[model samples]
Target: MSGAGNDAAAPPLAGIRVLDLTRLLPGPVATMQLADMGADVLKIEDPGAGDYARAMGPVRAEVSQFFVAVNRGKRFLRLDLKDQAQREQLLALVDDADVLVESFRPGVMAKLGLGWDVLRRRKPTLVMCAISGYGQDGPFAQLAGHDINYIGYAGMLANNAGPDGTPALPNLQVGDLLGGAQSALQGILAALLAVKMGGPGRFVDISMSDAVLAHNIMPLVAVNNGAEAAPARDLLTGGVPCYNVYRTADARFMAVGALELKFWQLCCDVLQRPDLKARHWQLGQQVGGADALAVKAELDAIFAGRSLAQWTETFAASDCCVTPILTSAEALRHPLFQARRMVSQERHPTEGVYWAVAHPIKFET
Candidate 1:
């Protein structure tokens, strides 16, 4: 909270204060990143249930993993914007705050008499980030949607999933967490720069659908060039051997990502097989091809020869891009992460000395 130049242990965002009015993944993840960077983040939740994600199925003795994953390092304040007095209190909270992020539906904030326009007037230098499923003025702006809906509507989900041409449900909230979180975070940073450059703080309108579409820029380009509707059928998705997951002898999997020629060559060399780099080893030019399948099969066979542990030991420092597929628990126990202090037991007032993902960051003087 002091001058940014004097402190070294202080985080990059040390003096920045964030008023988090968003619940759930998109906004919370962004604010969590900000908090990890030393911003003072205050989460404003509804009085009773708090963020709806608190009730989602995955739980830690009642606290949802969804909630725990993205809401750390921040103070919580329960405020109901529906109440006139509470709305005034929230407006007051934003008065001198550096940034405010909210993920309500397009017009909901204006309805509550706390829109960005009014807030900008009250706090001329406050950066306001409004996150929604769609943009503020679009036809689908008022429609309620989730991560899947956002990706699907953006033409990303339908093509990026499925195995046998059947559209598979995306397991992770990729669109919401990655797309919206990145968009909002970037907007907040840009807003901060705007505040520094001149006088007024900026309003950032971030649409989850737009974020998803932006994420699919490369694939969208391919589609625009007449690629198939279901593009996951491409070599990069699963059709190729050097870039896919193969089960080891013990049923644990190995993830191989030798996309470039040299990486693939090294993988073949490490596996003690010269047959993989054959003239036909390269993935063919026309979409998915036989070369891709052959390399994948060769990699699968090489990966299958040993148990995951043996493979892990054998290639611990080798140049091949092969890696063991890890579960969350195993990843949490990995030596590099342990050495980096990426996982630690942080005492949560409610949860108590629970395992927490340490902020994967550090500051030096």
Candidate 2:
């Protein structure tokens, strides 16, 4: 594992001050990433209840695990945005702060008299990022939405369906994590870079729906190439059996990504099924056809003959890109996770020991 350096060799974001007026997942996660990179992040919440996530999910002595999972390495403050005095206090922070992020619906910040126009006038070089369902000037800008709604609007949810063709509720918040938080962070970084290069500080308008739509590139590529790009019909979806999930004998799952002909051949060789080697997406096997279906069924039977552990053990050192579908707990205990130090254990003075998911990006000096 890589060692975290000393205070003098601090992170790139050191000396940056961020004012985060956000709740729930999106904006808080963006600021959390900033705070992890050594920004002095001050999360300002409402005086009455603070962030809604504080009371959500499983609580350990009044602290929510979900809240702590996203809101680490940051300071917290309570401020009533409606109160003139509190708003003035936030504005005072904004004067010296480098960035301000908010995830309110359209017009909410303006209603509080702390909008970008007002804040930019107060501090000319302050970067402000607003995260919402849609952009500030869209027809659906003010519409309330969550991860599912935004991905649905972007035509992504339609592609994610169950085996019975029913739309499955996804556990991963792709729209929230990818679209809102990551997009906001990227825009904030760009705006900060611009200011560092003597450019004007700007308003970063992030629409979750727009960001998700922008990420639906594969299916759009299919459509543009005159191919059918419906749900589960595209190559990357489930059209080919080379890249798919198979059920094990014990009812657990294994993910197979033997996409290339060589990898597929390697996988078939490992399974001792030389006959299946020729049945590949690139080997004239009809995708979504009877032959493909039969091959998948054959694979299903073969995989179901063994337990997840057995199959994983068989393919452990192979280059076929096969892995067991591990649960969250199993993932935490996995050797890969341990080696990368993706999870960190810290002993809080009052709260005892707590494990946190670490940032993925690494900067090498």
Which number leads on lDDT?
2
lDDT of 1 by residue, 1-365 (tens): 22345553566898899999898789999999999888999999999998998877656576776688789889999998899999899988887699999998888888999887799889999999998888888788888888878888887766766566656776777678767898989988988988899968899999888888888765767678886534454656776666778889999998887766688777777788867665223644333565666666667777788999998788777777878889888888888789877897676656555667866556655
Q: Please, what is the TM-score per model?
A: 0.90, 0.96
Residues 215-276, candidate 2: write the lDDT tens digits. Answer: 98886786788975545645677777788889999999999899899999999999899888
C-alpha RMSD values across all candidates: 3.0, 1.8
Model 1 vs truth, CA RMSD: 3.0
* Minimal lDDT window, size 10, model 1: 278-287
lDDT of each: 0.80, 0.87
